[model samples]
Target: MQEYSIAYAILAFIVLVLKNDIKDKFFFSLTFILITLAGLFSYEWKDNFTAWDIFSALGGSSTIALALLALLGYLDYIRQEEEVSIWLHVKDDKGNIIQKEDTNFSILRKNCTRQELQGILGVIADVPRYELASIKESEFMKDIDAIQIGKKKKIAIIVSQEKEAYQFNSIFNNKYKKIEKLKTQTSLRIDKDSLHDAKKILNEVGMNFSEEVNIFTKMIVTHKGLSFEVKIHNDEVNDLTDKLQNALKEVARQSKEENL
Candidate 1:
């Protein structure tokens, strides 16, 4: 029964990962293999009284361990890490102090997702997706919001997309959609249409909601203002926006949601 509990938990995880995006056929199949193997061992089988003793029977913690490893692998494949900075900055139009920029950005860093990148930039730049917690402990990244949690509890991180690299800096200052979110270099073919859907998905997924910096793009085939919306947690939001957009593209076009 204990094995069954763990196995079911793993299966649930597979379902959750798959729910993010089924477009990655490779990921889909990998998930299937993991769930199948986990179920096979956890479920009763004739002459397969393997139980939790899989480690001993397999001459080591190979089979069940492999199953767990497989689960981890799937998680690594689907789980997206977003880069955010817990920064200290100027306040609102009313001209009031925003906060310490230290404590304000600090708590948010600790609670929400955090990651490591090749480097940090005030604006757009290529950062290989490398998320890690230990990097948070570094003295160098002291001001960066390594974690974030709670209400009105917010974070401020620059999205590395060249188009909207100035998001954090321009949140209040930059005119909405004025800057061109360059299309060619954003590291992905992001569009305005899909980003809206991603916000709905994040809200549905229960992420703490916050504002986003706009990414400017080159004039599209329609010359439709050349820009896109990138919510907070630049990578995760953009990734979700892409997936949601792609999925919706496959979903037949729909009306635009103004506040993506």
Candidate 2:
């Protein structure tokens, strides 16, 4: 009975980990084998134990194990919420900051669903199938709510237990139709043309975009304006905004030098 209790407790813990997207099936099966071997050595089979007796053995420890798992999951969620952050900024044509807002990742993740994200992404870029699980995980894509491009356009990236997704919009086309987003790159100078250069510059400044990993990024350039959104990870709101502002300034300076 004691061995059964220990085995059930370990099984319960393994199930909890599996629930959190971590796989450890081998450990799960191994625990059962060890428990059965212990039972054989203990001469428990000689006691004529019925199959129904296993439930009684599992009852107490299994209950405790599940309770412990729930508590641990709750604590982990609280820690993640404390760490998640996003800083939204609006910049003018010359890289001057016009406005800003600070928000948390949890708030944004719950605000939208995956289907809506795909619709919005379709409007923003030519890419098809913009789902979260399909996206590769990377440093740049961690704990971000959204990124605003220029004064008018924006992209929001969100991840949830159910799905991961991204969406895009602009001041002029806040409710933009699917067809309207089909506007050609000729209408926009930067469109998809400058994404590579922008990523290269951002990488030079320590904001590396992992090509193999899914890092949500968008770039738009036109005769009217240019904007791109990149995910940032930092708990300190003010510090994140300061770093972003400095990076933008550096990018502008570089552009000016190239022109000169």
Q: Can you give the TM-score per candidate against the true fold?
A: 0.24, 0.25
Full-model lDDT for every candidate: 0.42, 0.40
User: lDDT per residue, candidate 2, 141-225, as tens digits?
Assistant: 3322221111112233333211121122342232222222111111112224445665666566555433222222232323224
Model 1 segments more than 4 A misplaced: 6-61, 80-171, 174-260
Error of 1 at 159 (Å): 16
Best by lDDT: 1
Query: How well does candidate 1 match the true structure in TM-score terms?
Result: 0.24
lDDT of 1 by residue, 1-260 (tens): 55447656775776665643444465546655655455556544456555555434343223544565576556544333323445433433354444333322232223344333323322222223323222345433443322221112335432222233234334433322224334332333335556665456545544323534233444422123354454333353576566545654542344443343
| Runs in model 2 lying further than 4 Å from the true structure | 1-46, 50-52, 76-83, 88-260
Number of clashes found in candidate 1? 21
Residue 5 of model 1, lDDT score? 70
Instruction: Quote the positional error of residue 229 for candidate 2 in Å.
Output: 27
How well does candidate 1 score on lDDT at residue 65? 48
Backbone clash numbers for all candidates listed: 21, 4
